[model samples]
Target: MGGDFGPRVTVPAAIDALRRHPSLRILLVGRQEQIDPLLSHCTSIELDRLAVVHADSVVAMDEKPALALRRRKDSSMYLALQAVADGRAHACVSAGNTGALMVLGRGILQTLPGIDRPAITSAVPTVNGHCYMLDLGANVDCTASHLLQFAIMGSVMVRAVENIDRPRVGLLNIGAEEIKGNEQVRLASRLLAEQKQLNYVGFVEGDGVFSGRADLVVCDGFVGNIALKSSEGLARLISRKLRRSFGLNLYRRLLALLARPVLQELQAQLDPGRRNGASLLGLQGIVVKSHGGANRSCFGYALDQAVSEAQMNVPERISEQLELDLQSRDGSVKTF
Candidate 1:
């Protein structure tokens, strides 16, 4: 986890994470002063399971990528990445610098065999039910080819997790018109339409993100990042509004007592941390990007989600589907 207040959050998060999941093992990497107390605080059984690497450096959120990596080779984040690459761990979960995570994850795990670029994927619930979005924020400036690759990964996720056959996909564009977008989006539209493996539903607008216009929403990271943040902000605002309504008066307070469970259910639905984090797709191993501000409950949720993703074998499924898509195309790296 990368943050200015590492001990304050990471320590508590790790403790709660262990309490929530009895079988989960954690490898704490940070300065001894920061990591030791947390490890000591864990239950005796959990303490036996907890290990530390005594990493002495850290990369701040604003530190430039090259500068952080060059100056802090033994940083906790770097050591954690090394654990994944060295096969010491099945997956790595972090609430740290995203770009640094992506950079380090790529350096260690590398991209999947057929994927041209790594995409960030997340499960998004629609008005109807749960679905997913790909390239949520990693590649801000995506190419037509990158979007196509994201579609493939998203399809695999839906099938493997939701058991959906030939899941439908939608491109996030200015208009549904075939040629309505900029050069990259326009080109991507054509590519998605031609991909036989995908159930491409054509272009969709931001309004349709959770309206069930499609099972998967694909976009460049810049737009996808904005959409994710907007959804999160709106969810929080709506939750606060509901709470205020319940808190209005004596009668409302009584009503609030009755409505507490309902509100809690709704808040759970909108809880960004409840969903925990987005999976970095098209990588050789699973790397969950938990929110950098995550606390104990949030970290536990992330660990649970990461376990599910690992058990689903997302990396293997992505590789298999991409290879099948590629091999079916006359044995060449042809355009989608």
Candidate 2:
């Protein structure tokens, strides 16, 4: 109901996800008229695990977050979030308006203790597997304290989801040198270095993001968003160029056939759809934001993320870690 394709894509993806995970159940919140046609294709067993919760409205893609929050009370996006907030669902996943999702998610679920705001976080494929990065576009402007908070949450997320021990965290900057970044970044770097619980690896440049110098890279939303979009554009450009080059002549076409397997592997690594879901970290409840333009396969990947995060109990883990860190700072446990 929220995405470009609405139930056409989401329903099939949900059914596919349900088939893959035997214990998984889904509460599809959207207009019943639009959703029923799609669910009609599901088998009786699949239907047993899926339930539809009708939502009469939907947030427009271009709608302002504040406006959507104020007006769209019965929207699919809002109701999906409400399901999570009301304890009817373990997590919420949407390929809808990102801004509205963030606004409503915060308004309803609230942030975890010690967290002032939720950050948009995601995993990017790197030379060494992948790296967890945040704030992808949540807070455009951030203070030193905010950046420090991002690092803590990101470190906890990577360790919980990826099973990395003492995940190395790096602050994104113009240069790797300690004195190279802006005052806010430098301040965040200092704060991060002082945290013994974190494996703070200092500053990393744009190139270092893919080089896997750190398991987690933290930045304000402005820079993080630009970097993410630029990387996606570049990956597409490279893939297109390769296809054109390979199809230029008969000899090249023959070469492409021989190299098909290797090229397929490379394409899989660079496909944005493979890592389709971005976690809205710092919120008390789990909410995964899928790419609005994602297709059925891509949407399935996002559902996979929601399932994994729910199973890992990421928010609770992060809250526990934050509490421990706060307690270590003083002899007494500080309330957040």
What are the TM-scores, per candidate, against the unseen true structure?
A: 0.85, 0.94
For model 2, the local distance difference test gives: 0.91
Clashing pairs for predicted structure model 2, backbone only: none
Clashes of each: 0, 0
Q: List where candidate 1 sits over 4 angstroms from the true fold.
A: 3-24, 41-48, 235-261, 334-336
What is the Cα-based lDDT of residue 233 in candidate 1?
Answer: 87
Q: What lDDT score belongs to each candidate, Candidate 1 first?
A: 0.80, 0.91
lDDT of 1 by residue, 271-329 (tens): 66676677888888888877877776776666766666666888888888888878877
lDDT by residue (302-327, candidate 2, tens digit) is 99998988999999988998888788
Q: Candidate 2 at residue 192, lDDT?
A: 92
Q: Where is model 2 poorest over a 10-residue stretch in terms of lDDT?
A: 327-336
